[model samples]
Target: MITVKNVTFRYKGNEETALNEISLTVVNHDFVGIIGTSGAGKSTLAMALNGVIPHEFAGDFYGEVLIDDEDTVDHAAEYFGRKVGEVFQDIDSQMVASVVEDEILFGLENFGIPHEEIGIRLEKVLRELGIEDLRHREIASLSGGQKQKVAIAAILALEPEILVLDEPTGELDPESSQEIFGLLKKLNEEKGITVVIVEQKIKLLCEYVKHLVVLDRGKLQFDGVPREVITHIDTFKRLGINVPPVAELSAMFRADGSYAGDVTLTVEEAEKMVREVLHDSV
Candidate 1:
């Protein structure tokens, strides 16, 4: 549902491009994860997906970004905003309304979605995110995970077909982070919403995201299934991704000829593999 073609973008005064000749395609119902070191263009790529690049950032943007076969450059930010919902790493930056209900309503109001439909949408999103009780809570009173859910709820009420998240769980605890990921996964798998996330938390991400895209120095280095991508452990390090301990152990096992099956990217998978291997040895 999304296509980026040889896109190169540079800030007005910067000599180097933030994104250089990057091309990618994401189909409908795809859950794609983007990972890389700082300045690798992961966030820049996310902006491009939803027209935040040329429209909001305003750079020397070259090439094309298309959503649903429609070139993003041809439309205004509002147009693309209707098609893509974006949640950034910082919860504070995304909040406008103090109360949770108004926070969710802000986007729907801006979009001119019917007022009658607004309440329904708001209620649905809050219920779906399991934050209905927080409808009247103050944004500042909520915890990091709660704020994250509110941020997502605000965008979700807009009912956009695609969701783009940049380090969404960056400020949350481990349990909270897992909850956020679980919500996103449910939105993707059950609702068929195309989900794309740019994250540095590879260990947590590897367990949920089915597809992985790696960037290096503003270029696409790798794109494939996460389990398969983890097998190329050295490439991840070269790209500056911190390989999770589980992934590292899986790679070491493969190298020693003790585990020849597909790479494991999650703790559950690793545990199952270890148990099976030990049983066979006994």
Candidate 2:
């Protein structure tokens, strides 16, 4: 659903490029997670996916970004806006309305969606995002998690094909972060929405995302299955990102010659592998 080809961008009066010949493809309905340390160009890459590179930010650009076979550089921002829905790290910055219902309807209204249809989309989004009870509540009164949900509902109301999130859980507590991750998983699995999330929370992301992409200093470092990425625990540590707890434990056992099986990335899988090893040894 998205493609970047020889894409490189440098800010004005800057000596270095934020992205260095970066190229990636996200297929339809794939859930991709991007990880990296601070200043790793993760956010810059996310912006390029939806045409926020040269279009919204002034900079020198080389290469093409295509979404659904249309070139983002050639098209207008309004055209790109309809195809991609973005949720930023700060929920407050994304909010344009005071009430939940108004916030959800804001995008649809801007797109010139009809008045009657706006009501239908708003209801569907509220129900799908599990915010129906919050429909009439004040945005200021909602909790952090609720605020994030409302932000997501507002984006989903646009009916975009791809959802791009920049640290959606950055400001929330652990419990609230889990809630946001769960909603992203549901949206990707049940609704078949293409998801691309840039996050620092590797442990939570490993639970849901099918693919992982790591960046370092504006370069693509790793892009593959979650299991494969986590197997190199040392590399992840060096990059200042944590391996899933299960993966770390499994690695320890492997190092001690206690288990010689496949690397596990989830809690359940790690448990099963360890149990078999113990049983064999007995």
Candidate 3:
């Protein structure tokens, strides 16, 4: 659904590029996770995906970013808005409406969607995101998790094919973060919404995402299946990115010549692998 080719961007008066010749493709229904330390250009890359880099921010950009086969850099902001839906880390900053339902319907109403259709979409989004209980609640009264869900419902109401979230769970507690991540996984699996999330919670992402893209110093350092990326514990550690705990434990067992099977990224998989190894040895 999106293609970035040889893309590079440099801010004004800055000597270094925020993004350096990065290239990647996001297909339909793919759950892609991007991880990097502070100033590693993860957030900049997210902005570039939706044409916010050069258009919204002053910068020199080179190369092409195509959304649904259209050149994002050449198109207007409104055009990209329809193809991409963005949820920033700060829910307060992205929210424009006071009530949850109004916020969800705000974008659709702006685009001239009929009032009747807006009502239907509002209900559908509320239910789909499991935020029905928050429908009439004031935005200011919501918890961090509820607020984030409402924010996501607002973006989902646009019905964009691609959902780009920058640390969507950054402000929530662990339970709320888990809830939000579960919804994202369901959306990707059932609705086929292509998801690109720039997150610091590596362990949560490892549980659901199909692909992992690692960035370092404004460049693509790794891109592949989740397990493959997780297996590189030393490399990830050196880059200041945390490896999944399960993957780290599996690696330790492997080094000791005790684990003979595949590396695991989840707790369930790790438990099964360890049980099998112990049973066989005994």
Q: Please, what are the lDDT tens digits per residue for candidate 1 over residues 61-152?
A: 99999898899889987788877989876668878998999888888999899989998998999999999999999999999899899999
Candidate 3 residue-wise lDDT, 212-241, digit = tens: 899998999989888887788898999988
lDDT at 204 for candidate 3?
Answer: 87
Task: Indicate the worst ten consecutive residues by lDDT in candidate 3.
Answer: 73-82
Higher-TM-score candidate among 1 and 2? 2
Worst 10 residues of 2 by lDDT: 82-91
What's the TM-score of every candidate structure? 0.95, 0.95, 0.95
Error of 2 at 49 (Å): 0.9
lDDT of 2 at 275: 91
What's the C-alpha lDDT at position 207 in model 3?
A: 84
Candidate 2: segments with Cα more than 4 A from true spot: none
Clash number for candidate 3: 0
Q: What RMSD, rounded to one decimal, does every model reach? A: 1.6, 1.4, 1.4
